[model samples]
Target chain A: MKQACSIPARAGIGLKPSHYRDALDSVGTIAWFEVHAENYMGAGGAPHVWLERLRSNFPFSLHGVGLSLGGAEALDQEHLANLRTLIDRYEPGLVSEHLAWCRRDGLFFNDLLPLPLNEESLDVVARHVEQTQEALGRRILVENPSSYFAFESSTLEEPEFLSELCERSGCGLLLDINNVYVSACNNDFDAETYLGKIKAEQVGEIHLAGHAVEHLEDGETLRIDDHGSHVCDAVWGLFEKFAGRCTGVPVLVEWDTNVPSLSVMLEEASKADRILTQVSSH
Target chain B: MQNGDGDTLGKIVGDDSKFSRRFSVYRNNVYHSLTVALSDAYPVVKRLVGDDFFLAMARTYLDGGGFPVHAPLYDFGKDFPDFITGFAPAESLPWLGDVGRIERAWLQAYHGADAESGGMNLEALSSGDAERISGLRLVFHPSLCIEQLSWGAFEVWEARGGEGVAGMKVEARKNFIVAARGMDGDVRVGSFGEGVFDFFERLHNGKGIMAAAGDMDVSVVGEVLGGLVRLGAVIGVEE
Candidate 1:
């Protein structure tokens, strides 16, 4: 997996350990494979061995979820060094982080957490992104996280914040359509409006995933970004509209939890490929 | 921010109260992810306790100040096995801590670095170079870990999905379990006699060859050393 290992601007599915054998049996199928950087941080194990075997077949996208890019504290140098090693070794087509904080005061949450979209937090996030890009010596992509809460202190909308961060830090955007849909539905906004704000050129990639619907006791339903099922029709509809915006950006189907059979994931990727084919000419 | 719930989110980020209702979702995400990681790490412990009990226990572990100290959550529960010793609900199960200890050792060995450190390490020692060997320290494989259990809890672990460790004898179980990474990168677990366990434990504690060998039984030392070499658990002699 190197910069020359191209990911055809098609749809790919996350290469989970459970699907590794099946994925190998069917090569030249997916556009690329994406894995969480933290999952590979171990010094050596079966994960690395399996990943090494798969790397020869597909380009990779190292998506990091635990960098705590939006934290108030300084960027973790040790983690950055490990990430640099990964980038140097894999030479992934694209590397990405999130617009969220998961660690505070040396405590790790291990989940994508929201941040206050204010000037202070934005400054913190931009500095971290710059530091990361400098450390990796590559242009990295920052993802839009699904939010379950909003802060009064958040002055900038997520799209504006991400846009400015790109301008300031020379990074790219990974516009996740599923996140926009889940966040919009959760926060009382329109998903299309969220995606409409993102310019196509800024987006280096697109993420589409499934989320769970949790019904509240107060008779209100909230969408949780669980990534444990098929991409709902609503999210698929939004991805269709969003695809025309980014003509060649690689789209990924992520199913992290309750991962079904490999065939099911391939079906989702096929659905995305069909959609991408339908919209590519536009 | 402190409570990490919707109300705390509102106080820090939101001026309006309308978003407070959405806090449970994020809260569930955080706790659910943390518990899932813990559950993955300590599956046997979760199985020992049912899912609901384990989930509640994991939530308590989080709420009672058990946050991960690193970026990646791989080493999140470094102290969890130790934490289980004092937990009240599991107090009735005396062998629980020992099982936890063995599982933790297995995980550590599995995640440890790649080491082709094995060699014909003990070959020269057979020639009776006593003085030279005394000053020489042995290099153990990077993934090697030796744990002495209160009982042979490996039986329980092997039977995790089956009859479980119910009514297993603690008295007859003088267990010394060792975990090491095989050449093929899988973690392998084995149990050794007391003499072999002591020899490795002494070496792990940086004891000199003479000091460790003095405590070793005469007959088993040959068998144990040969077995360790065969297992590729021993690295070269360190000077």
Candidate 2:
């Protein structure tokens, strides 16, 4: 009786507790939804209850932030088993995690920290991705992380590293356009070039979110991936470009902080839908 | 972003002169989100200490370096009560830590295991002789948690909206507070008399009827048994 519906390649929104009730009622235009797997790892409770009812109405994707897939140590067995339990219970249409590490050696930072883009770090991440896919018995899309600063030892570019990660592990890329633009501006790289280098066919999903331009004490600008506002014109433009390439991948609008009402979130989803529709028609 | 002079992040932004200033965005985000998570987990503590102090305290708690490895923030703050007891600033309001304990218990119960609350198989229960009732072992609902506190934390919780509790004097009496989620999918907190709470606590810990009921009034045993069953708190009882 507990299960999930299959999703289409349309716009979806990240599941937030504030919008769970409306999500259950139904947002007709939205094709599916995603949630952080860490939030649902509890033994049981209201989150599962609402999710159960909503799962029947909408397909779900288990996106994880705390699994530390890119952690240098061996893949965490307990976290893997917990994820397995969710996958079995929900049978989500897609499963995904970020291409970043938040934890290492039994310590967690509670944020998606960037990894070095070189041979050694690549191998560590690929092995972990392979282990996760094999354990879940499902292919997962790994989202590109939004980085404020890069590692000095990093050799390969972000897209080249991601392309190799996919080629080696068979995991698809969840291209977050905002992350592309933010990272590009912050680190002084060309966003279009970054998008061009990624193997288009390897992209299984796209993400669009709002970011804030924080002015530091010094007269300089830094783009923060806050997800507190609407998707900016710059990020949306980048998404339109990537949307032309990936063609039919589902695009998700993630609004974590300053979560507006369900109607506001749905409006964002509809905007993504418009872009996706235009791409499909073309 | 919390800014620092560390050159590591700056190396990533190779040509940038304002690396620390630029890197402050991520630093700020990480601290902001994690601090919000801490506040959500410890709302009563937030209410007691107010926003600025609570956020600052949450940061201090995070800097303690023992935040659970790989656990969701929902299951976070399990050690917060102990953390508060040792925090120097909070020493003036000692009961603040115990209030945190109750809040954590409430969250655990709210998110605890889901189970169908079963009534005692009356057919199995009634057929037993009167003497057999005293030896029966009982199972409490899966979400049940009873915390013994030496402060009027529940009184503070109950009086949340009636009036502000700023200058209220709370008596420190031995209290066994109950946190239980019913089948209707709501978690509620209440109090249990010392004897009754102990009897259930012992039974909850896997003790059999006679052993768990030690020192409880025999005359009131039937009353506690009936009340607990009517409340759907007992799942299975071995006679």
* Model 2: fraction of the reference interface contacts it also forms: 0.63
Report the C-alpha lDDT of model 1 over A1-282, residue by residue, as the tens digit: 113326668888887889888888889766678988888888877777888888888888899988989887888899999999988877778899999887777788777878789788888999999999889988889999998766777899988999999999988899888999888987788888888898788888899999999888768788889899999999999999888667878889999999999889988999999999998776
Tens-place lDDT per residue, model 1, B1-239, is 33844443335434344455565555667788888888888888888878997888787778888878787776887777767767888877667667777788788888788775455455655656657766656666788777887666777776763454566655546668877776667676777766466677786677766677785554666566556656556666665
| Residue B121 alpha-carbon offset, candidate 1, angstroms | 6.8
Lowest summed lDDT over 10 consecutive residues: which window, candidate 1 chain B?
B7-16
DockQ of each: 0.61, 0.54
Clash pairs for candidate 2: B1-B27, B1-B28
What global local distance difference test value does model 1 have? 0.79
A129 in model 2: Cα distance from truth in Å? 0.9
lDDT of 2: 0.78
lDDT of each: 0.79, 0.78
Q: B32-135 in candidate 2: lDDT tens per residue?
A: 77787778877878888889988878878877763556647666677888888789998888788778878887888888888765556534445546577767
Which 10 successive residues of model 2 chain B have the least lDDT summed? Answer: B1-10
User: Cα deviation of A140 in candidate 1 (Å)?
Assistant: 0.7
